[model samples]
Target: MGPFTFISRNSTRIIAGAALLGLVLPGLADALRPFLGYCVLTMLTVSMLRVDVASFFARVRRPLPAICAGLWLVVVFPLTLLCLAVLLGPPFALPLGLTIIFIFVAPPPIVSAPAFAMLMGLDGALVLAVTLIGTVVMPITAPTIASFFVAETMPISAVDLALRLALMISASFALAFLLRRLLGPGRVAAARPVLDTVSVVVAIIFALGAMDGVGARLLTDPGLTLGITVGSFAFALAQMALTYAVFRPFVGVDAVAMGYAAGNRNAGLVVAALGVTQIDDMVWLIFALSQLPIFFFPMILKPLGRRLVAAHSAVPNARSLP
Candidate 1:
């Protein structure tokens, strides 16, 4: 079996998807640039098709957890990173802060809810619900938050974001609905493997675009690149720790979901937003490279998550009491 086959069978395909993106697309640099937007459209389309909107939302039988997850994306994430960026302050500080805020404002990872549900052992259905809701909300939230650090570049207001979001969200929902309907219910089970394969292809193309977006800058400043990578990894670890502290009191699975979501910012969106300006683009190379941390975090965390699951399962009378 291919290494991808191994990853496909596991819950860490999100990382694998990113790695494939980084490695596979640079050769197609010329073609990849103009079409990065289409590459994004494909990923989003696949994500939408995979979602069962009615079924996903139905799982949110309660209001509080859903609300908390929303708050994480909209408020807590941005505010926390803004504080961190201010505290860090410089060559490393402003750019790193922009990376954090760019992603904070960007849409949640395309696969985050599902990946979090699987890896952290949360309710996949509920996670899916939250992800869908967050996505619809992102276009508005993203530009607004992006404006704080990047005022000059972000001339488009939240109203524009709302309009753009409506278009993209509608496109996602439409394509997904058609694809799923054509696949049919029984055949849908067989499609996961196929969809996973396609996701890898699209991911590589997306990564290539990301690489090209910053390739020139990366070639110029090795020190800045190194600093951003190290700093980003540190930030990721901090976010994960914060997530665990916040959500552990609620449930282990919930903690896992929040931890991954909080830690793994969508690098594609981060890169795109930073590309809004020439100066921002120059600094964004480091931020783009910084995303390597997410693609690696799973190796250590996955095994630990499994152990936590086993330990939780072993708790005497816990299940019965609940």
Candidate 2:
């Protein structure tokens, strides 16, 4: 097989290796930080290039599940985190709480989510539908929710952040459409492995950018850095478990897809919007550590997904039963 094919086939390892590189080479992350917006746009565009617009729209037309996923992701989940922050007022600093809220409120990781779902033998179409809606609505809902939680203290104004998000998302969609028009669906389909390779490479750039300053923070405050890293992993796993349980009763095997979306947020989007310089060190540390689960969870989740799919299939009229 060609290099692209090999890279695509080993995407999980590629992601893990890229993440390891980011942790070890903090300077590379700092170097790439300036171009994070372009990197994000490229990742989003490549992800969208392989989508079937017609099927995506058709799924949108059946909007119940998508809306449920959106509301849960953008609203309920953030609010739950906000409430927890409020209840644990002393332990959770205002800035750290807001940072946590920002991470949860952000849209699903559009670039790798569908690919991850497919890798696990789950419903990629369902993931695509939910992620698209969540991403498109992020500029509006994210800003509105963020304004309530963060208000004047936010590094960027709500309106400005929303505008940037809208522009980036729009530009990605437009570029992806242009590519699809030029390449045609047949070519796009045939080039899935290449696109996957491109997506993983873009993810590596993002990982590097996300890890900017993380190593320095680790050296400066080892205890705080370690605490936040562990906390981030716990939070991610808890979010996944809760979301899966809640949706399993209603959606069966698709619950795993929703859970993945809930757990793997696009914290990079928030990081890009706020800019690395604008964020506090603690907040940056948390955000950087949160990326761990997003990159590595696929390894743990793939076998679980297969088991869930098999279990669901064994049931009579599983969809109706749910």
Candidate 3:
């Protein structure tokens, strides 16, 4: 096999390795920070180019479940977190709590999600549908949610936030359509491995950029940084668990897919939308550490995913879509 094939096959390791490198080499983060938005747009463009539009819309036709999942991801999840913050008070009303809310307010990380779903033999189509829906609605939902919970903490005006998100999503979809028109869907589908490799490489660049200033923050206040990092991971796991439990009754392995979507938010989008330089250090740190679980936990969860896939396959008339 060629080098590209090898990298594609070993994407999980590449992702984990890239994330570790980012954590240790804070300088790369600073150097790459300026290009973070470009990287995010590129990754989104490539992933969108590869989307199976027919499959995506077929899932969307079943509007009840798809809308529910989308609402859960973009609206319900963040509101729930806001309620938690309200009930907990004190520290929960602080920057850390706002960071937690920001994570959920962000859309599903579509960059690697569909690829991860395919890798684990889960419902890639459903994952993509939920991701696309969540992303498309982010412009409307994200700013509204942010204003409700973190307006004081946010650096940008609500209108600016909405405009940035809309621009990002629109630009990505436009580029994707142009690419698809030029390359044709068959040609694009044939290059799945290449797309996956490119997505992973861009993700590594993003990971490095997101990690900017994290090391200094750690050095400045090791205890607080460590606490936030741990909390980030815990929040990620909690999202997954809560999503799985809530959606299991509707779909089996598909619930797992939703769980993955719920847990792996596009923090890059939120950061890019907000202007990373304008955000609080604590917010950046939380987003940075959140990447650890998003990239690493897939490897840890692969076995369970495989089992879930196998079990779901055995069920009579089992379908990934509700």
Candidate 4:
């Protein structure tokens, strides 16, 4: 089997990603200190280019599950996490709580969803739909959700966020259409591999950029830093668990599809928002650390998702008997 197959089927990728983050984290000054936001913008742009807008909205005939997942990410999950942070977490954890909530409120990651769909054997179209929908609705939904926790620092302006989102959607739609019309359906087959490689390189650069000033902050206030690290991880785990729970009843193809769509999100968008709002740098650190959960979830959950897909695939001609 190939490396991705082996890594996806086991927890190796997750462990490796976490280990790399840990090992490099202490020495991030050399890697992430200078180019954080610029790197983030590079990855975000690549992800935007990868979107297949036509395919995303074409399958809207069966959009209930996708819409529900969007609602959860943009609404229910954020509120619940905020409530949990306020009620149960340490008082100082407020910033981390806000950071976690912010991630759920942000638009979907442009690259990860497609990668996730392939890994878990989900319908790429479905994942794309959720990604499109989430990004479209983020401007309106995100500010509304973020308002609850950040009324002071940012005070939540839905109108401003919505305008920004509209520009992204319009640009993405135009690009996807232009490419589709120019290259036709078959082009995606060839384009995907190149895009995948580009996505990874861009993601690494973006991630490094986000870490730019973090080493100093991490060194200055290790306690707060530790809280963010732990809080972000816990929140990521909770979101993943919640996603699985919501889709468990639909085991098989739908289950895998839902799991992939639900689990993967555009967390980097939230990181961008943190920058735009000029919130505390600690908040950005929390969100950056939260990316670990996104990277690792497929590794942690793909085996179960694959097993479900296999079991379903085994029920030969179950849905198509002549």
User: After superposition on all CA atoms, what RMSD does each candidate show versus the true structure?
Assistant: 4.2, 2.0, 2.1, 5.4
* CA lDDT of each prediction against the hidden true structure: 0.60, 0.79, 0.80, 0.59
Instruction: Tell me each candidate's TM-score.
Output: 0.78, 0.93, 0.92, 0.73
Model 4: which residue pairs collide? 32-212, 33-212, 36-209, 39-206, 108-266, 109-265, 109-266
lDDT of 1 at 253: 49
Give the deviation of candidate 2 from the true structure as CA RMSD: 2.0
**Residue-wise C-alpha lDDT for candidate 3, range 79-137, written one tens digit per residue:** 87777888888887785677657654556655668778777777888889888888888
lDDT score, candidate 4: 0.59
In model 1, state the lDDT of residue 188. 62
User: Where is the poorest 10-residue window by lDDT in model 4?
Assistant: 7-16
Which ranges in model 1 have alpha carbons more than 4 Å from their true place?
1-7, 10-31, 52-58, 83-100, 104-106, 116-122, 147-149, 213-220, 270-279, 315-322
- Residue lDDT tens for model 1, 1-322: 7655654665355545554455445556435655555666676787777665566656565556656776676566776666666677764256444544555435564454465446555456656655666666777677666666655444355556556656766786788888788888656656767776676677665555555544444457767766766877887778767876786666544565666666666655434433324325544455456556656666657776676657766765432101
**Candidate 3: misplaced stretches above 4 Å?**
314-322
Clashes of each: 2, 0, 0, 7
What digit string (tens of lDDT, one per residue) describes model 4 on residues 1-322?
6553444344335444543464356565345434544444554454556656676666576677677766766677667667777777666246655555666545553446665666766567766666667777777777776666655555336556556556655665576567667776677655655655555555555555555445566678888877876776675555556675666554335545655554456666654544534645656566556566566666666687678678877875433101
